[model samples]
Structures are given as structure tokens and as C-alpha cells.
Target chain A: MSSNKQNEIALAAVKLFEQKGYRATSVQDIADAVGLQKGSLYHYIASKEDLLMQIAHQAILQFNEQLEEILAKEDTARGKLEQMIRTHLIMSIDNLETTTVLWREAFSLGEGPQEVIQGMTDKYLNLVADILRSGTETGEFNVTHPRITALAILGACNWVYRWYHPSGTLTAEEIADIFSKLFLDGLLAH
Target chain B: MSSNKQNEIALAAVKLFEQKGYRATSVQDIADAVGLQKGSLYHYIASKEDLLMQIAHQAILQFNEQLEEILAKEDTARGKLEQMIRTHLIMSIDNLETTTVLWREAFSLGEGPQEVIQGMTDKYLNLVADILRSGTETGEFNVTHPRITALAILGACNWVYRWYHPSGTLTAEEIADIFSKLFLDGLLAH
Candidate 1:
């Protein structure tokens, strides 16, 4: 199969998986969406799990690249963390469907694939924790559990996909700005 | 059906729903888990959606009671928001299985049930927004979008079920304390 055909199948899989869910969306559904028979589709992709793995890998590739670049900087921990949040929000907004599929169906993947996806997630987690720790070292952040706090921040970002509307009042940039400020300054008026 | 039997079915339904998901879980699975035949299970509940509606109502009842009490108090907006965070964390921790089901599967519910759940969620959101608004009015908080900020905080709490472990070092109380403080003091150390 040409790389273009593979990309076509993968995009269809992401849309079907997001709409009907992972279990409910069969290989046939993906094949139909791509205007091919199931047999022909199999020639382009290995299996349903393989489709999911492909989509997941595509999403993770972007995530790893952005985070890797962000971490390479010698900026303060707070600066790195702010950039991390900004990157995360941008990625989630740009790839809303892919992000939804990865967040919702990644857990249902087979152990090997689950571990692969999880390994990517853990890298993000650890990067956040590292920033929190540096903040403590530099007296920029005070926290009892750097790890849990990191999880909370990521959670807030992931949960946005559930309610974010494209035509909503707040643009993605505005939403990201509000999130960073709310998280950084909190709700304190004084 | 007796209330005890209904509760038993609801409990079994929640567990099965969490493990197999709402769409994948069959009525037979829930019945078998509750030690009843499928025919007998229908006598106790209207449908699978009914089972979910029951569970959601239970969760919402507790949520409303706590938020109502907290909102009625003359406490500062910051204090009320903290209490809301604490109650939310405690509820999510104590009702882990139910919370997981509610967060993950509640959207699959029928229009009537979905509206019901959304109504309760909106109440919580409005209450949080009100607190944030009060903070602004009293010169106690700074926010560009109080409603969005409220959603972010709740998202953080709701997403906890994905990663929170019972064996984790931080107990629910400690986690609540840390969360309340983190949202208030933020990551900045200065």
C-alpha cells in the first residue's frame, strides 16, 4: 500500500473510533469509511488494534517532539512548565479528534500497546514533576507532592476535550492563557 | 424490588460498567454479577440506562447536598471554593467505582438521563462560578472567565479517578488538603 493509502485508513479509523468508540467500531466500519472492502483494508492495515496503535503513535510523535524541545531549554522550572501547558493545550486543540481517541481508547489497547502509550504519558508526567522539583530547588514552587500536582495539571488539560466546543466563546489560545494564569496565580485577589 | 435488592443491583451494575464499559456491558452481565437471572433483573430496573440513572442520581444527591450547604455559608469565596474542592475530592475517592462510571459512561446515557446529569454538573459549575464571581466583587480574586476556571477545577477533581490509587501515600484527606492549597498558592514559590 502507498503511504497515502495508509494515512487515509488511519484518518478514517480515528474518526470512526472517536464517533462509535473503539469496541463498537469494527474493521469493516473503517473499511467502509475509507470506501474499501474489509479484505482490501486489511492489506493496508494489520488489524483493529493495529489501527489504534497507528493513531496512537501518530499522536505521541507530536507530543514527544514538542516536549523534547521544551525540556532542552535551560529556563527556570516555572518557565518550562508554562511552555509545557501551552504546548499541551495547542496539541489538544489542533488534534481534537485524535486527542479524544487517544485519551478515551488508549487504555483499552493490548498490554504491549498500552505500555507503549503509557510510556509516552509517563514521560510527560515525569517532565512535569521534574519542573516542579526544580521550582522547589529555586524557591519558585512549594508543594508536598510534585507528582500528584503534575497529574492534576494534566488532568485539567485532558478533561478540556470533553467540553470544549469549536465555536465556543473562548478561543484555544484564550483558554490556554486563562488556564496558565489560573494555575499559576490561582484565584487569589489579594 | 426492595431497596436493598435495588442497591445490590446498582452496585453490581457500577462494577460491571466500569470494567466492561456501558456499551459493552450487557444486562446479563449485570444480572449474573448480582446473582440474578436476566429475567429477574428486568423486574428490578427499567433498563441499563435506568441503572445508570440511579447511580448518577445517588452521586448527584450527595453533590447537591454538600454544595448547597457550602454555598449557604457566609464563608469567603475562597473558603467556599476550597470546601467545594475538598468535598469533590472526598466524593471521588470514596465512590471510586461509581465516580469512574459516572465520568466515563455518563455521556452514553439517554437524552433524559444525560440532561439530568448535566443539570447537576451545571449546578456545581454555577456554584463555583458564583464563588469566583464573589471573589472578584469582594476584591479577593482575579479571573477573566470565572465559568471556565470553575470547569478546570472540577475537571481536575473528576480526572482523579483515572490515576488515583487507594494504596497511594496520600490519603483522600491529605490529597484534598494538598489540592486546596495547590489551587490557592499555585506553583510559584515567591
Candidate 2:
């Protein structure tokens, strides 16, 4: 199988899955999008679920790679948190279709793939929590519950996908700055 | 048509919709859940989409009513914001199944009902933004871009449905308090 053809098929799948939903989108629709016959499409992938898992896995890998780079930085926890939010926003907006499909369709996968995605999500949550815990210990942050706080911060960041658009007034960087300020300094005037 | 039976049918639909995606669930499945014949189920709802609209409408109505009560109070913006978070948390957790269905499946409705839910959602976002704007004007809150801030705050709150559980260590009120504090005060040590 040509890797180029596989990549093209994967991209087409994400587009259809995001717009029509994973269940509503059919394998033939994806094949049509990529200018391939339904039978020929199988040359690159086993089934629709296989294509979905590939896209979902790729999304998570990209997220984890970016997060790992941010974690490797020797900045303070606050700084690293800001970087995490910035990276998340940039990636989410840039890959909006893929992100949408991953969030919306990953659960529809079989148990093994679902568990794989869920496990990656758990690790992502824990890494955020670890940052909060370190900040608290270093007296840089005053969080009472690191895990819950992490969830709130990430939730705020993730929800950007529902509204962010390329033509929107605020760029990803601007939104990231706003979120970082909101999380780090809060709404209080003090 | 018996309102009691209608209510039972609606409740069962919410449960099934939450467990199974709206597309995958059949009218027959909903009827089976409520011990009603498929033909009889049509007596209560015009179609599966109609049932979804009813549930989604009720969810938005409950949210709006709670928010109105909170807004009617003459509390300070800080106090009201805290109350808003608390009210949202409690209501969301209490109606977990309904909320799950609303968030996940409401968009699958036909354009008309989808518009209705979207309109209500826009109004809700505007109301939250209004509070932030007033708070900023009153010099009680230091928010910049109230609309964006509102989205972030609500996003954090709404994402609670993804992870929250009755068996979790923290109750809804405790989680609400934590979120309120996080939103109102910076994570950085004062």
C-alpha cells in the first residue's frame, strides 16, 4: 500500500467523520472523497474502524508529543502551564477537523482502541495535575485540588474547539494569552 | 394521550440516548425500554427526533429557570458568579442523564429544533457575559473580554459532565466551590 494513498484516505475520513459524524459517514463516502473505488480503498485500510483508530491515534500522538516538548522545558510550573494551553489551542484550531472527530468518535471504537484513547487521556490529565502539584509545593500556586483544577483548566482550553474559527477575531495566540491570564491571575482585581 | 405515560417514555428515551448514540438508537428500542408497543409510542411522539427535541427543550428550560433565579438575586457580582457555578454544577449532576443526552445528541435534531436549542444556548452565554461585564464595570471583577471569559468559565463548568460521578470523592458543592475559587482568584499565590 502506498503511504501517500493511506494518508489521503485518512485525511478524507477525518473530514467526513467531523461533518457527518462517524456513524453517519460511510466507507463509500470516504472513498468517493479521495477519488477511489470502494473496493480499491481496502487496499490501504482494513475497515472503517481501522481508519478511525488511525486518525484517533495520530491525534493523540501529536498532542502527547507537543505536551512532552513543553514538559521538557525548565520553566516554572506557571510558565509550563501557559505553554501547554498555548500549544493545545494552536494544535486544536489547526487540526480542528481531526480534533472534532477524535473527541466525537473515539468512543465508538471497539473496546481495545477505546481503552487506548482513554489511557492517553488519563495520562494527559495526570501530567496537568503534576504541574499543579509542583506549583503548589513550590509556593508558586495556591490550588487546593490539583486534579480538579487541572480538569477545569484543560476543559476551558478544550472547549475552544467548539467555537474557534480561522476567520474569528481572536487568533489562537490571543486566545491562549487570554486563557493563561484568566487561569494564572483569575478574575479578581487584586 | 396520558401525560404520565408520556413522561415515562421520555425518561426511558433519555436513558437509552445517553447509553447509545441517538443515531444508533431505534424507536423500537425506546418503546421496548418503556414497555410500550412501537405503535403506541407514536401516540406520544411524532418521531424519534420529536422526542429528542422534547428532552432538549426541557433541559434548556430547567437551565434557564435556574439561571433566572440566580440573576434575580441582588447579590454582588462575585457572589452571583459563585452562585451561578454552584447552581450549574448541582443541576448538571442531578440531571446527568438528561444533560448527557442534551450535549451529545441535541444537534442531531432537525434544523428548527436545533435552532431553538442554539438560541437558548446563545442567550445563556450572553447572560453569563452580562454578569461578567457588570462585574467588570463595578470594579469587582477584572475580566477582559467578558464574552470569551464567559465561554471559558462555562466550558470549565460544562466539561464537568465528562468526569464527574456521584461516587467520586468530592460532592457537587465542593467541586463548585473549587471552580468558583479558581475562576475568581488566580492560581498564583497572592
- Please write out the lDDT profile of model 1 over residues A150-187, one tens digit for every residue: 88888888888788889888887888888888778777
DockQ of each: 0.72, 0.84
lDDT of 1 by residue, B1-190 (tens): 6989998999898998888777788999998898999999999999998888888778877888899999888898888988899888998999999988887777777788889898988887888888988888988888779888888888888889888888887888888887777777677765
TM-score of every candidate relative to the true structure: 0.95, 0.98
Off by over 4 Å in 1: none
lDDT of 2 by residue, B1-190 (tens): 9999999999999988887778888999998998889998998899999999999999988888889999998999999899899999898989999988887678688889999998998898889999999999999999889988999998898878777888999999999999998998979998
Give residue B161's lDDT in candidate 1 (0 to 100).
88
Superposition error at B139 for model 2 (Å): 0.3
List model 2 lDDT by residue over A29-93, tens digit each.
Answer: 99999999999999889999999999999998898889999999899999989999999989998
Q: In candidate 2, which residue ranges exceed 4 Å CA deviation?
A: none
Q: Which candidate is the best by DockQ?
A: 2
